[model samples]
Target: METKELLKKVKEIELKTRGLTKQVFSGEYHSAFKGRGMTFSEVKNYQFGDDVRSIDWNVTARFNEPFVKVFEEERELSVFLVLDISGSNNFGTRLKSKKELMLEVAAVLAFSAVANNDKIGAIFTTDQVEKYIPPKKGRSHALMILRELILFKPKHTRTQLDIGLKFFRNIVKKRSICFVISDFYDENDFYDALKIANRKHDMVALRLYDPAEKELPNLGLIKMFDAEQGVVKWVNTGSKKVRDNYTEQYEESQQKLHDIFRRSGVDYASLSTEGKYLMELNKLFLTRSR
Candidate 1:
């Protein structure tokens, strides 16, 4: 994209996403993902309703009065967006491509983090880690991330999700809320890495999909392209057996993905490219808040 066009696109996304954050996601996000823990704020005179155990004995002795250490919830967080920019994500049969949907969803998340006064960062990956933007706060930083998401071009076309997860684990030492945005279309096993990452940082998987992936239309014989493999093959989509097998494979993959998330104790939501992503995201946030 040209510079002027790219800047315009970034501004548009920022406006839309920032509006959504202010109107919808800000409060829900705050409730869903809390800060690291409570931190000591200051010492105040103990009140009648105050917890008796919270009274600081040293302060009480020095001041000759009961004083309790006041603590506040640390509301700052480092949020990481682990985005998949593999070749398969570029295909969509509906209104927008999977990559486009992913970018919008990620923008919403970035704005939500900004609204909550948290630092936002991203990891762009194909088969390998393409780029890493360290966490930073403010609207400008979020817009910078949006620009990068719009313009980044990966070197590889394959999907090795484990590489991205491991790279995130190695670089991000501080505990963070990591959102893995992808179609989960990899052939490799990333369960162990995902589980380990979840143990240290709160992980949420946002799986993107399109309608065509779940069901194939009977368009007679058609050429199908494997984006990751960079290969094309002719397939008879008119065959009932072929269509049934395709549906079965998709269902099996979905089941396996759900199983992995469940076993890893990670919260996840599937958003269809043709469906209302806001509803799915709201549902996930409500579930997490509870």
Candidate 2:
């Protein structure tokens, strides 16, 4: 894209996502992902409904009156967006590509972090770690990230999600809320790495997919391309056996992905390129909040 066009896109995304963050996601996000813990704020005179356990003995003794320690939730946090920029995300059969949907979802998350006054960062990966943007706070920083997401290109076309997870584990020592955004299309096993990463940080998987991937339509014979492999083949979409096999393979992969998330104790939600992603996100947030 040209500079002017890119800037226009970034600004548009910022406006839409920032508005959504303010109007819909801010409070839900805050409730879903809390800070580390409570910290002492001040000591005040005890009240009838106050918790007796919070009474400060030192302050009470000093003033010869009942005083209670007040504590406030530490609201500051670091949020990381781990993105998959592999070739497969560029495929979508509906209104937009999976990559486009991923970009919008990422923008929403980054804005949500900004609304919460948390530092936001991103790691781009495509079978390898492509780039790492350090966590920072401010609208400018978020816009910079959006720009990168729009213009950045990857050297590799394959997917190895473990590389991204391991890179995050090494660089970000502080515990953070990490959102791994991808289609989870990989031939390698990343379960161990994902589990280890979640051990130190809260990990959430936002899987973006296309409906065509899950079901094959009766479009007769068609040419199918494997984005990651950079290969093409003719597929007989009208054959019932062929369509059934395709659906079965997709289901098996999805089942395996779900099993990994469940066994690793990581939260995840799958969104389709043609469906309402906002609703799915809202459901995920509500589930986490509870």
Candidate 3:
């Protein structure tokens, strides 16, 4: 992409997503993810209705007056966009590719985090970690993330969400709100890693997919290629047995993903490239609110 074109795309996305954040997601984002914890702000003279447990005994003794330590929730949070950039993301049969949708989703979340005055960062990965943008707060930082998402080219060609989770756990010390945006077609066992990561941080899964991934069109004959592994095969799409087997496999994958998410206790949402992402996001937000 040309520099001028990329700039326009970034500006366009920033305007759209930032506006949505202000209009719909401002309060929901704040409520959905909490801060690290409460921290002491100051000590004030005790008030009648103040919690007795908050009393500052040392301060009270020094001043010979009852004082209470006031603590406030740390409003600033660090949000990590752990994105997958594998070749399978290129196979969307909709308005855009899964890769395109992933970028937009990440951009919206990044803008929302920045709108809430939180630091936003990202990690672009395939089977391995490709890039890491350190957490920072500002429109410039968010734009940088958008630019990276639009132009990033990964050296690897496969998906391993497990590696992404490990990288997140190792680098980030303080608890963060991590969003793993991917199609999640990996065979690697990431359940343990995801469970551990969720224990330490607030982890949410944003699964990007296409409706065709679940159902196949009955074209008489079709040639398919593995996007990541680069293998090609011709299939008799009209055959009932073949269609049934494909449908069974797709259903199993969906069920396993749901079970993994449920067992991990991580909040999750899915975005289909053929569907309205805004509606999906709004539904997820409303569901979370409930």
> Which has the greatest TM-score?
1
**What's the alpha carbon RMSD for model 2?**
2.5
RMSD of each: 2.2, 2.5, 2.2
User: Candidate 1's residue-wise lDDT over 40-141, tens digit each?
Assistant: 999999999999989999999998999999989888999999999999999998989999899889999998998888999999998899999999999899
Tens-place lDDT digits, model 3, residues 30-143:
877778689989999998999999999999999999999988998889999999999899988889899989877887888888788899999988899999999999889999
What is each predicted model's overall lDDT from 0 to 1?
A: 0.93, 0.93, 0.89
Clashing pairs in model 2, backbone N/Cα/C closer than 3 A? none
| TM-score for candidate 1, residues paired by index | 0.92
Cα error of candidate 2 at position 120, Å? 0.5
Q: What value of lDDT does candidate 2 attain over all alpha carbons?
A: 0.93
- The candidate, 2 or 3, that scores higher on lDDT is 2
The true-versus-predicted C-alpha distance at residue 249 of model 2, in Å, is 1.0
TM-score (C-alpha, index-matched) for candidate 2: 0.90
lDDT accuracy of residue 170 in candidate 1: 98
**Which one wins by TM-score: 1 or 2?**
1
Give residue 86's error in model 3 in angstroms.
0.5
Ranking by TM-score: 1, 3, 2
Clashes (N, CA, C under 3 Å) per candidate = 0, 0, 0
- How far residue 133's Cα lies from its native spot in candidate 2, in Å, is 0.4
lDDT of each residue in 1-290, candidate 2, tens digit only? 99999999998888887787777785799999998668999999999999999999998999999999999988899999999999999999898899999888999999888888899999999899999999999889989988998899899999999999999999999889999999999999999999999999999999999988888988999998999989999999999999999999999999999999999999999998995888899899999898
Q: Which stretches of candidate 2 lie over 4 Å from their true place?
A: 40-71
